[model samples]
Target: MPAAALKNKPLPTQSTAKRSVLFDSPYAPMAKHRLPAGRPREWYVTHNRRLKAMRLAIALLDSGVYLANQAHDETIRSTAEEIGVHPPSNTTCHMVRALMRYSR
Candidate 1:
């Protein structure tokens, strides 16, 4: 296909585009917002708290699982229970599969 004949994807769904701020076209002026100086939102704090707890759970895996690089298993059970976040699916297959992939 020729570059001139290519088509762009439609605008993403809200949940997908909400996190992006960059504009792709010269004709599209960026949306401007004036945030009041100082102070962050309560929801941001709660989000950070969950992220911290998730990182702690990943660190706990170091003793038993030998996952390569920064490949953290997103599904953590015990730490999730302790922190009162969503519980992982009650399965051990994820770790075994991760190990099998790394060995090859």
Candidate 2:
């Protein structure tokens, strides 16, 4: 516990340390997390909408669609399909454009 004892301790070797799969492969698929139960139905709806919007926004950005006006509802929906997600609702499309607008 003393400073002298700490200074005498040898650094941990790789064999002694725990390794994370994420560290070995940064792009590895992550485990899905279960959402807590007992929340209102509206809460889940909004949560999923936000996630869909975020994914669409990122896809648009990656595809070189920078401006909110440039990202039409059809475009966002098509991107969602391309990314293997169901087509988003109009409200989700609006949220995606808002995300793009505010990201600037």
Candidate 3:
């Protein structure tokens, strides 16, 4: 969409948590470590996945593991757990792909 055509449209809402675990994931700019007051748990749940994924991606990057393809998905998940991000979900995996894309 043209920038002029997109004027007045609301940007998508993002997480507002206080991210204690800092990293260089692309999503780092948006992810926080704690939910803002008054936000519903449901809202937090929806947004926190990206933060978790960001942490996992940072761990992989630190380990020199750049994603090559889906073949890297399992490695990503294991890294997630090793880094304390348990039960890595599909959304987290998607974020990992995104991180790798930007890095490349």
Candidate 4:
């Protein structure tokens, strides 16, 4: 089976009515205010990149390698330090230490 077919498979039906008080209220007509514009916000791009870096850092840390040996380690650290508003937590520091030992 192809991926598209699997996704199109019928879902089980529920017996109860799927209703929301928000939709039934007079405010429903003005709910357009709740919808987001279909464009990426600046913060979204920044946050997404930060999340990607963090994930990569965690993977490196898990592999038990020194970050300095990795091609992108310096870039990751520089970007993280620049973008990060606060210092990493104790857990994050511990993970970095483990990676350092592994690299050695």
List, in order, the clash count of every candidate structure. Answer: 0, 0, 7, 1
Candidate with more favorable, higher TM-score: 1 or 3 = 3
* Model 3 per-residue lDDT tens digits across residues 2-100: 889666534222312222222333332334465578988878886777767767777766656665463265666666544555667777788777876
Q: In model 1, which regions exceed 4 Å deviation?
A: 1-38, 50-55, 68-75, 82-104
Per-residue C-alpha lDDT of model 2 across residues 1-104, encoded as one tens digit per residue: 78775653333223211221111111222366887899999998999789778877977787678899888777776666556588888999899999999998
Model 4 spans with C-alpha error above 4 angstroms: 1-40, 73-104
Error of 1 at 78 (Å): 3.5
Cα lDDT computed for each candidate against the true fold: 0.39, 0.70, 0.59, 0.39
Residue 92 displacement in candidate 3 (angstroms) = 1.3
Ranked by TM-score, the better of candidates 1 and 4 is 4
- Native-to-model Cα distance after best TM-score fit, residue 81 in candidate 3, in Å: 1.9
Q: Candidate 1, 1: how far from true, in Å?
A: 71
TM-scores, in order shown? 0.24, 0.69, 0.56, 0.30
| RMSD (Cα, Å) of model 1 | 17.5
Model 3 accuracy (lDDT, Cα): 0.59
Order candidates by TM-score, high to low. 2, 3, 4, 1
Model 3 Cα RMSD, Å?
A: 14.8
